[model samples]
Target: MNGAGTKRRIGIGIVGCGGIAQSHAAALKRLEQAGECTVVGCADLVEEKAKGLAEKFELPSWYADARRLIDRPDVEAITVCTNPPFHVPATLMAAERGKHTIVEKPMTMDLAEADRAIEATRKANVRFGVIFMRRFWPGAQRARKAIDDGKLGDRLILGDCILKWTRRQAYYRDPWRGTWAGENGAALVNQAVHALDMFLWLMAPAGQLETVYGKWANLTHPYIEAEDNAVAALRWANGALGVLSVSISTDPQLGARITVTGDKGATVSVTEHPEGRFGLNDVWTIPGEEEEMGRLYERELQEGREHFKPFPIAHFWQLQDFLAAIREGRDPLVTGEEGRRSIELIEAIRLSTESGAEVKLPLRTSTWVPPTRR
Candidate 1:
C-alpha cells in the first residue's frame, strides 16, 4: 500500500550470511508473508553459510559467490551484509546489474571507497542506501523533529554520544572480528556507529562540523588488534561543541545514548538501554511538555517491546522504506550520501588520532590505513 500502487511484490536478494544477515532474513521473512516482498536468494563466501541461511528462510536459491546471486533475474534489490571490506564491492556488483542496494552501517572503511560506491550507484542510476535502522526508532524521529521545530531553541550548545558496551575476549575468536582489514575499527566503526550516525543526524540543524580531535587505544581485550575504546571532541560551524565516547570494555555495559542541549536551556536525550532495543526518550525538557516525559517513555517502551517481539521491527521498517522507494522512484531516507557523512566523521577521527592534530571537515581523499597491529 503506502503509495506502492498495487505493484507486484519486489524480489529481494541478500549478500553475506553472517549474524546480521540473519536479522535481515528474519525481517524479510515477515515482509514475504505480508506480500510486500519475496526473498529470491542469498549468498556467502562459505557454502555452508549460504546454504544454511537459504534453508532456514526457505529462500529460492543460494550461491557461494555474491555475483551469482546478484545475477538472478528476479532480484530487484539486494542488501549487503558482508564485512566492511566487501561492502563497496558487493554494492558495485548490485549497481552494475541495476539492482537497488542497501548496505550495513559504516558504509565503507574510508571516504574514498565511500565516494566510489556513491559514484557507481549514481552513474548506474540505481537507488543506494545504508542501514542506519535505529534512525527509524520512534524516539530518534521525535528528537529530530524537536530540533527542526525549534523546541530546543535556535542555537544548539552541546551534543553528546555515549556507547559503553561489553564484548568478551571470546567474541574475537573469529579471525576477522577485530582486524582493521576485517571489521574495520572496532568500537567506533562497528558498535558505536549507530549512535554516532544518530548524533550526526540530530545535530545537522546546528550546521556543519568544523574540526575533530580524537584518541583511541586497546584499553582491554588484548586479544584483539583494534581499539576497544575511543573518544573524540568536535566543533561545528555554528560554534556548537560535541563529544563522542565509546568503549567495548565496560564490564556491565552501560548501553548507548545521545543527548543535546540548546541555548533555550532545554535538553533532550534518546537512549537504547541493553542495546538492540528500540530507543526511548529518556530525557525531555521542552517547556510545557516536561510532565509528559515519563508517560511518553513508558508508552513507547511497551510499544517497542510488543513490536520487536515479532522481529527486529527497525530493520523491517527500513527495508520497507527501501522497497517503497524503489516502487515510488524516490530515494530511501538513508541514502549513500547520508551514510557517507558518518564514515567521513569516523575517518576524521582516525586521521586526528594518527596526526595528533585536529582534522577538518570535508576531508581530502587519501590512501591512509590504520597501522597494523598483532
Candidate 2:
C-alpha cells in the first residue's frame, strides 16, 4: 500500500484536529475507498479531539502526541495540521523518520521555520509538498498559460491584488483566532497567503521580488494581537510590481478572491473554493486575440464541468500528485522551497511594516522558533 494506505498499504497519520482537519479527513475517506490511501492513525494535543476525528473518519487509532503517532511502524506518511508555531517540529520530526509530508500553508508564519521545513524534507529525501491547492484552479492554470504565451503583451507583473473579504468579530470570536503568536499575523499570512500564492503562480519565470513596503494597522479589532487588515507593495526583479490588500474585519465575510492586471489585458479574478463546482474558473480578455482566447476558454469551461464533480474531493488532485511524485521519486507541483517563498515574502512584508523599509527577496531567516506551547 502507498501513502494513502492500502494497495500500496501505505500507513497515514494526521497531526491536528482543528477545523481544517475535517476537510482533510473527508478527503482521506474518499481516497481510501478508492484504494488510493488508508489512515493508520491520527494525533492531536488533545487525545479525545484526535480520537473524535479518527472515529468520525473511522481511522484505526489516534494519539495525543504527533511524535508517538509518527513513530508508529505502520505510518509511511503524515499531514501536519497543527497551528503556526508547532508546524516546524511536527513536519521536521515526521521527515526525520523518513516519511512523506503534506504541510499546511504559510508553513509557518516566519521565514526561519519555513526554511527549516524545506531543508528537512530535502535532506530526508521524502516527498514534500505545500498545500497551496489554488494551483489546481482551472481558471488559474488557464490564466497562467495565457500569461506565459505572452497573450498579455509585455505584461508588467500585476498592478494590484484586491482581496476585499468580510469577517465580523464573530469570526475572530475565538481568542486564538487573531493573536500574533497564535495565528501569526492577520490578513497577510492568514487570508492573503492564498491570494499571494495565486499572485506568484501567475507571475512565475519572472525574477523574485526584490522589495516590499507594507502599511498595516489594528483597524477594527484592537483586542487582537495582529492587524485585522494590511496592504503590501511588491516589486519584482523585472521592475514589474504589484499590490496586495486584505482585511478580516469587513462585513459579510466575502469568500477568498484575487484580481490580477497586466499591460495588454486582464483576468478579473481567481478563487480557490475546493468544495465549489468550478474548482477554478477564469474570465479573460486577450488584447489582439480575444476571439481565439474566448473560444478556448469556452471549451475549457465545458470540460471543467465534466471533470470537477461536486464532492469533498478537492485535495484528491494535490494528493494524487504527491503520491505520484513519491512513487516516481520527484518533486510534486508545489515543492517545499516553492511553498516557503510565500512565507518569506510575507515575513518581508511584516518586517517592512515593522521596520519601515522595503526588504529584499532571498531574505535571511533568523530568530527561528521551534514548536512549543506558550
Candidate 3:
C-alpha cells in the first residue's frame, strides 16, 4: 500500500516497547527523515510504555495488542522488537496482515518457531528480513570481501570468541534477566548470537554442522534459569571447525569478538558496542588482508560516514533494503530461511549441552518443542 503513488514513504509499526524498541523507534525516525518510512504506532503489554514511545516519536497511534498494531490500516511494515518468546506470533501476525518485517535476531527461541514463521512469510509473498548487522560492518565487509576475493583462501575455521559480559547480581535483579523461560537459553542464545551469525556468514562453511559439545553452569550469577557460563565445539560441513567460548559471568563487561581463519590467514574481529546516542561500532580485523580492507575503510572515512558501522549499518542497510524490496519488489539480503538456519544451529548446540553428544546440523527435531510464554 506504500507505493500508492510514486516512491511513497512506508508506514511502519513497532510491536514491542522494551529497551530494544527504543532503538527501532530511533531507527524508524532516521528512516523517516531519509524519506524511506513513517512511524505509525507501537504496542506493548505495558500501555504507558507504548504511549511514551508513540509520544516521543510523534507516532499517530498506539496499541496494547501487537495484532491490533499489525492490523492497522496505515502500517505497511513492522519491526518486531519483543523478547524471544513473542517473535513467532508477532511474525505470523505481520505476515497475515500483509506487512513487511524487520525482526531482530536469534529470530526466535527454537528452530520450530523459526521454521513456522519463515514458511508463513514465504507463503505470504512478503519481504521478511532479520537483523544480522555484523555482516554490514566496515571490517566485516572487508573480511567478507577477502573471503569472496579468495584472499582468505578456501574457508577454514571460525573461532567464535567472546568474553563473558556484564550481568551483575543487580543486572539480574529484574527477575526476568537471567531465566530460561524469560531469556531462553544461556550465554549462547542471548549473548553470542551476533557472533554466531557472523561466524557462519564469514566462514561460508559448506557442510552441515557434524557435531557440538557444550557445558554450562551458574558459575557466576545464580538467580537465572539459563547458565551464566557456557562453551561449545562446532565441526562444519566442509570439515572446518569452530570454538565457542562465552560466559555471562564476566563482570565489568567485555566486548564480543570472533576470529575467522581461512586457507590464507586469520581475521580478528570486534563486536560493535553501543556508541553514545547515535549508533553501534562492530569492527573486523583481517590480519593480512589489509589492502582490500584499507580501500573499503578509507572510502567510508572519506564519505564522513563514521556513523554506526556493522550492526547499525545493517540497521540502515537492511531497512533500506527491505523498503526497496517493498517498493521495487526484491528479496532481502538475509531471508527467512537463512534466519531459521541460525535457530536450527542454535538448537543443535543447545541439544549438545543437554544430551552430551554431538548434534548434527540441519538438526532434525520432530520432537522440537516451541516456546509458550507462561
**Best-matching candidate per TM-score:** 1
* lDDT values, one for every candidate: 0.88, 0.72, 0.69
Of candidates 3 and 1, the better by TM-score = 1
Stretches of model 2 off by over 4 angstroms after superposition: 1-9, 154-156, 253-257, 261-268, 271-282, 287-310, 366-374
Please provide TM-scores, in order, for all candidate models, with all chains considered together: 0.96, 0.86, 0.85
Compared to the true structure, candidate 3 yields what TM-score? 0.85
All candidates in order of lDDT, best leading: 1, 2, 3
Top candidate (lDDT): 1
Q: Per-residue error at 259 for model 3, in Å?
A: 1.2
Ranking by TM-score: 1, 2, 3
**Range of the 10 consecutive residues with the lowest summed lDDT in candidate 3:** 273-282
Task: Encode model 3's per-residue lDDT on 199-255: one tens digit a residue.
Answer: 677666535667677765667665666666767787777777788777666645355
